[model samples]
Target: MAEEPAAPTGARSPSTRGTRRRGSARHRSYLRPEQPSGSPATSRAARRSARAGRRRRYAMEALAAFAGLLALVAFVGWWSEPARQEPPQPGGLPAVVGRPSLPGPVPTALAVPGLRPRERPPSPSPSAGPPSPAPVAVPTTLTVSQADIPDTVHLTETGRRDWMHWGLGGAGGTVRKRDGTGELRDLGGRGDRSGWDGNQELFRWRDGAPVKSVEATAEGVYVCGTGNGFQLAVAADGQPRTATVYLGVWMARGRLDLRSSDGGPSRTVRLEERHTSRSAQVTIRFQAPEGTRLLLSWTVEETFTPHCGNVGLQAVALR
Candidate 1:
């Protein structure tokens, strides 16, 4: 090359340095990432604004879609609603409206094996009824009479209902019928009574109370003076019954009075023995209503002697 003019003292040597200029080059470092254009706080605010805008847009879109779905459901229901109908009147018969629903099946009773089937009886008519029961006839007859003393006086239980005997253990003691009906009662008397074993007629019994058994005995009780005697009663069951009272009089007139405790007919009989002891059996057959009593009262109507002439009682039997 034409001898290159001698390079100035400040120029590069030709072997290593080029006379033409080289293209410009630039280099970046991976160790440090590049930051955005603005300051750190400003860049973060811008990113947040962008994200919030996107989120709001998405939420609006979702809300709008939900509102549209509700509107669609309402519209569908309103348009497809069923029409109104009148209720079926109860008075309308099947011929007029046809049966709205089929009748329910009736229950049928089935016969059990080896068993008989019984049909219900028909109801009774109002116009007719079973014949009324015949009116019961009540026994209303009462009779009082005197009778002779038999040869043998059965003083025991004697297959009768009840019996009461006085003076069995002397006076001031009594014996009731054992296991009897408890229909006979001694109601006490108005006067003083005493024990006497002088009665001629014999008394015997095997069944009694307080005194279980007794042999032949002539013991009795007596009340002295006029208008003083003994009282007795037998319960009435609206049936006929008989009662025999063993009584006696010594030198006095004795009176036997009878009546129904509930108030009815009354009868009287008299026995007089002014000189000696006289005995008799009064048979009284009476009938009265239930809850009545056959009352017997023996009183000394008159006295033959001034010294304690009295009416005597031995025993009473019932049937």
Candidate 2:
């Protein structure tokens, strides 16, 4: 009766009809996905796609973290280390104090096998100096006489003439004969006797032939000839202030030169045509210094053809 009264005005009875509808709707909504349901294969494909997306997001996050770590390490390294600096060069001003100086690169020593060791340079000797000059042996007094002349003269007789051959003596003197027949001849105008003629001439022997005649003088076992030069070295007994040379000449037309080892000045005497006929004499005077050797030399130049003359050193006196 009460229910009949209540249902009288637009009120439905609480029945299972509305309950089933709401419950089914809620069940359908709960069971249905937001996206439409596809086939089984499509569903599996969608699930695989979701898994792949999740993996990609995780990979990106890991990569970002790794990049941040690398940045942090680089920053720390840059801050902890010192700034690089160039090394100072030599011959320049020194680096400022309290500033760190970079060390220079060390030089490497190279080693080679089978190589010889380097030789050390010779050290200078402290006691080394220029050597002293050698002392020259000077005679206290010396005399040159005809007896001191070496007996090395040669004479050969050939019927009408005689030949005199004399070599350069051991005193290191030279004799050169030119353009003459070097023979002692008898000057008897024409057809004269041979052995020791009072008038004899000297000739130059050249090419095994008698070429020209030379003037000669026979004086004291010595035959001095023209065009025959001689250099004689004589000793001095003492340091003489002056020297006088006596020359024995016949028909002289030559020159006499005097020199000394003491470096004294040289003197020359020339004989002209005035003393050409017979025996003549010449004197050469020169200053002689102490501790000096004397050298006497005679030279004859053939200015005129058949120039007849002979010269010899008779004596040399030093005082």
TM-score of every candidate relative to the true structure: 0.58, 0.27
Question: Judged by TM-score, which candidate is best?
Answer: 1
Best-fitting candidate, scored by lDDT: 1
**Root-mean-square deviation (CA) per prediction:** 22.3, 19.1
RMSD of 1: 22.3
Report the Cα lDDT for candidate 1: 0.80
* Candidate 1 lDDT score at position 246: 87
Which 10-residue window of candidate 2 scores lowest in summed lDDT? 185-194
List the candidate 1 regions with Cα displacement exceeding 4 Å. 1-137, 157-159
Candidate 1 structure quality by residue, lDDT tens digits, 203-315: 77778787877777788899999899999998988888888898999999999999897777888999999899999998888888888898889999999899999999988
